[model samples]
Target: MNNSSKAVVSFIVGAAVGVAVGYFLNSDKKDELVGKLRYQADKLKDKWKKKKDQFEDALENELA
Candidate 1:
């Protein structure tokens, strides 16, 4: 297989392993886990937004 095909196969296998691990080690504190994950995701979103704005501002400054 080519590079693209190899990458796709690797991703599928990794995803399958991750699912199996999550299934077997199911956490009892489901709500808490989900909440923490959501909180982290929001924080990441904020960081990305800040970086995007900075990049846009720098580009505008360079042009002007």
Candidate 2:
């Protein structure tokens, strides 16, 4: 809670972030990981769209 403690924590976090960025930038599998992440995002979008459509249909049925 002190200023000195806060400074130390900030330094540690900055170091960790620098290390992570360096690793990702130097990693050979970065592209592969990105592709997988993108694929997962697309699948999630499709799933949400399907759920929304189903919810809308049910709502219309109830109102009818």
Candidate 3:
């Protein structure tokens, strides 16, 4: 698959795994667990977005 598609799939899979682990670890503190997960996910998403933009810019430059 292409780089963008692969990144999306990887993010989805990572999110699923994170949710499962959080649920198992904090069965009674679901809100807290979800909040932490959301924060981490957001940070990861921002990092990925920056990386993707950089990659695209490089590719465009290469083509140009």
Best by lDDT: 2
Order of the predicted models by lDDT, top scorer first: 2, 3, 1
Taking all chains together, each candidate's TM-score versus the true structure is: 0.58, 0.77, 0.54
Cα RMSD for candidates in order: 7.7, 1.9, 14.9
lDDT of 2 by residue, 1-64 (tens): 9999999999999999999999998899899999999999999999999999999999999999
Q: Where is the poorest 10-residue window by lDDT in model 3? A: 22-31
Report the C-alpha lDDT of model 1 over 4-64, residue by residue, as the tens digit. 9999999999999999779756866777878899999999999999999999999999999
**Which of the two, 1 or 2, has more TM-score?**
2
CA lDDT of 18 in candidate 2? 100
- The lDDT, on a scale of 0 to 1, for candidate 3 is 0.94
Query: What is the Cα-based TM-score of model 1?
Result: 0.58
Backbone clash pairs in model 2 (N, Cα, C under 3 Å; residues 3+ apart or in different chains), count = 0
> lDDT for every model?
0.93, 0.98, 0.94
lDDT per residue as tens, model 3, 1-64? 9999999999999999999997778787877878999999999999999999999999999999
Instruction: Mark the regions of model 1 whose C-alpha exceeds 4 Å error after superposition.
Output: 1-28
How accurate locally is residue 25 in candidate 2, as Cα lDDT from 0 to 100? 81
